[model samples]
Structure formats: C-alpha cells, structure tokens
Target: MRYSKEHKNQTHARIVKRASVKLRERGAHGIGVADLMKEAGLTHGGFYAHFDSRDALVIEAVTHAMDRSTERWRKLSEETPPEKRLSKIVNSYLAPEHRDNPGQGCAVPALAAEIARESSKTRRVFSGRMEQMIDMLADQYPGLPRKAARKQAMAALATMMGSLVMARVTGNSELSDEILKSGRDAVLERAASSEKKPPRRAATSV
Candidate 1:
C-alpha cells in the first residue's frame, strides 16, 4: 500500500534519526543501507525511497547529528551566564555521561576521521556543518575579536575532541576519567586566558 506524504516524511525522519545514532556508534562505513533500514523498522527495499544511495543517507545522518549537537549546546549555554557559557559547554561535553555514551554524543569526535576519508560531497557537507559548530562556540568566547575567537574555538574543540578520543579508547577507567577532567580544565584555562587583561607596569618608587 502507498503511504501519504506526511507518513513518508515521518519515515524519512525516522531513517535519518536512526542512521545518525548508528553512524556515531559505529563509524561512517561501518553501517550498511540494509542494516539502517532494518533498524528504522522498514524493509531494505524502501531505502531508495528516502535516499538515492547509502552516501546520501550518511550525509543526512551526519548533518542531523551535528545539528542536534549544536542545538543542545545552545540550550545548555542559554541556562548559564555569558561569561561561563564556554566553560559550561566544555565541562558538559567532556562529562562522564557523554564520554560513556558515544552513540548519543557529539559526532565530531565519533565520525570526523572516517568522514574525512569519504567522498568529496560528504567531506564538504561535514566541513560546513563542523564550521557552524565552531562558529557557535566562537561566539561564546569573550574578550577576543571575531577572528581570534574563531581560532580559540578551533583550539578548544581540538583539545576536547582529542581528549575524548583518548578517554574513550584508554584501557583504564581512572585514566579515562582523568582525561575527561583534564580536557575540561584545559578548555576552561584557555577560556580564562583569553579573558585575561594585559598586566600594567608598576609605578616606579621615587
């Protein structure tokens, strides 16, 4: 039986949502179209109805994941004061809850490397999404010009992403926890340093 337009849209959303989580839990190439469709509670034959190819689904999935993450960041930051926004973001992202749950966590650390090696179309889409994330973070950083803030955002994100990767892969749980803490602390330090005013020269004694 043929589904209505609304039903088709819902099905398409379900497929993209499931694919988003699966792609993060497993790398970009780790999931196949058949498996994705199956997890989405649909038959493999319907996969082409939503997307032209597995790559198309992947692009949609990555965009969906990153957009969700950015929205979450905005929500979390909104609850905190302006000065503490970046700190709050860093801490929450590196928190144990996020670290232990890679499937629902940020896509940057999960699928970035694999996406890097994918087709140019995928890379361009991923790049654009990632830049949006960076630009969002850049705005939260204070005391810096826009260009400088963008650089700081890049550095902060790099540290957080690398630390998260190590934390996830390390054999010891204690080390994993430490890695998370260090990443949070490091980002907070970076934020603090950026906000520091220049030291003034002391007045000479007569």
Candidate 2:
C-alpha cells in the first residue's frame, strides 16, 4: 500500500518533531537512526525518503528545537512588562526544573557543548538561532538605542546560559541553586540599572 503526498509530509513533520525532543534529551549521537525511526512510527528504510542523511535530520531537529524555544520565550515575554521580562526569562531558564528536563527546555544551552563538535552546517544553524533569540530579547527594551539593547540582550543571555551550564556540570544541588540565583540576580540588577541610566550626551567644552 502507498500513502498520499500529504500523508508523507505529515509523517516527515512528525519525525522532525519527535527527533527535536529526542535530540534535546539525548544528544545527536545518543539516538540511533533505527530507534528514532521506530519512535516516530516509521520504518528505518523510509528515513532517507524524509531526510538525505542523519546529519540532515540532526540539523532539522536542532532547528525545530530552536523554533520551539523562541516561541515559548516570545509568549512569556508578551505576557510580562518589558522591565520584568528579563528577570522572568532568567528565572525560568536557570530553574532546576528546566535544567532537569532537557526534552522540554531550550536546546541552545542544553546542547551547546556537544554542538561545538558538530558539522559546520549544524553550527551555522545554531548561530542563526542564537541571533534570532537575541533579536527577540532586544524587542523587549523599547526606549533603548539598538546597540545598547543588543548589548543588554547579549549579557542577559550569556548569564542565563552560563548559569545553566554550571548547574548542569556541578554535582551539588546547593551549588546549582546558588549559581542560578546569582545569575538571576545579576541580570535583574543589570536590567534595572539600564532602565534608570540617562542617555549619554555629547560633552560640551569645559
């Protein structure tokens, strides 16, 4: 029996979606092609029909994960006031729950270490996703100059990612919590200062 084109497309999408979550939980190498195909309810032979190679599938999966995280951050950002958005994002990103559940959290920080060794194509996708994430963050600051806003966004993102990485690498739960709290406080404090600072003006002759 044969399936319709639409059905094939749907199956392919399902495979990507499933693969995205799996990739987060288990790094790219953690999942075998046959296992992934079976998990997607498709045959291993059909894998090539949907993707040229496992590398292609890995790239697609990473892209999908990035898209999912972006949407989640957007929704969270939209609901909160601009001033509070960074704090909320930091809290959520650095939380123990987010750290423990890689399948449902942001893939960028979760897979950052592994992605360093991935193919150039994969790294490029990751870099593009990071840029989009930064842009989304910059949108939260309405009155700031574009350059200042981007700088602030970069700082906040770096803090959040660094905290999560530290928490994941440390064995002590107390230390993990401290790392998250410190990161959150640092970002919130910095954002508050940014909001308060007056724009710099051209210096006049003394």
Candidate 3:
C-alpha cells in the first residue's frame, strides 16, 4: 500500500523517536534494526524506506535525543535568573530523576562511549550536536569572556557527565546521591568563583 508523503514523514519520525529512547536505554549495539523496527510497529523490510542504513538511523536518533536535551536546557536557562542559570542547569542535569531515567536523559552520559567507537561520519554528527550543547552551556556564564566561558562549560559538562555515569553504575544509592550533589556543588562553586574575579587588564607596554 502506498502511504502519503505526510504519513511517511510521521512514521519516520515515530521510528526515530523510539530508536532514540531505546539507544539510550541500551547501548548503541544493544538493539538490532529488526527489533527497533518491530518496536516502532513496523516490519524490518520497511526500514529501508525510511533510512538508508542502520548507521543512518543511529545518527538521526542521536541527533534527535541531543536536540531534545538542548531544548530542555534552553528552556531552563530562559526561566532562570541570570545569576542562577548555570546552577539551575547543573542541578537539573545531576538530579536523581535524570540519573534513574537513562532513556529520557542526556545522550552524552548514555552514548558517548559508544559514539567514540562509531564510524567517522557518526562521530562527526555526534560531535556537531555536542558542540551545540557546549555553546548553550557557555551562554550560562555571561560574566566570563567567550573563551573562558567555553572552557568553564567544558569542565562543568565533564563533571556532570562523569558524575552521572558513576551515579548510575554504583550499587550504593546513598553514594549515588552524594555524587550528584558533589558534582552540582562543584560546578556551581567554580562558576561562582569565576564570576567573582575581576577581569584581568591587558598588559601595557612601558
């Protein structure tokens, strides 16, 4: 049966959305194409109609997941006070809700390791999304220069992602919570300190 163009687009989006959650819940290689198609209520044979290859689907899924996360961060930043924007993002990202819900949380903590081993094209796609995330994070630090803000964002993101990975893997629930708290505190502290320091004046020649 021939599906209309709008219907095909909707079906393709549904498949990609499901794949995004499943990819995060399981590793990149954990689920097969057939299973993903089946979960989307379609046959494996129809996969080719929507995507060129499994790698293509994977790239699209990763991009979709990161886009959702970025939108959430952007909303949080807009709703928060200028002074507290970074803290709001950090706390929300490191919260227990995010840790316990891998399928619905940030892709970096869930798929970074797998993406690192993927093909160059796949890695490039992931890198581009990550750059968008980093730029969004840098915007939270309005007090710093562009270079310094980006550096701070990188460190904050590393801490948040690392803490989340540890929190999810550790057997002790208390330690997991502590890890989240420590990560949030550390990021906020660093941001606060950086904003407090006066900008250095360029050295003048004698």
The most accurate candidate by TM-score is 3
As a TM-score, model 3 comes out at 0.97
Whole-model alpha-carbon lDDT for candidate 3: 0.93
**Which tens-of-lDDT digit does each residue in 1-206 have in candidate 2?**
89999999999899999888888888878868999899888789989988999899999999999998889889998898876776677788879898788898888877888999999999999999999999988877777899999999998899888888788788348988898889889987888888899999999998
Tens-digit lDDT track of model 1 for 127-199: 9988999999998976787888899899999999999999999834998999999999998887887779564
Model 1 stretches with alpha carbons more than 4 Å out: 199-206
* Predictions in order: lDDT: 0.89, 0.87, 0.93
Query: Which sequence of candidate numbers ranks them by TM-score, best first?
Result: 3, 1, 2
Better of 1 and 2 by lDDT: 1
TM-score per candidate = 0.93, 0.93, 0.97
Clash numbers, per candidate: 0, 0, 0
Which window of ten consecutive residues has the lowest lDDT sum in model 3? 170-179
Sorted by lDDT (best first), the order is 3, 1, 2
Which lDDT value does model 3 have at 5?
Answer: 100
* Backbone clash tally (model 3): 0
Prediction 2 TM-score vs. true: 0.93
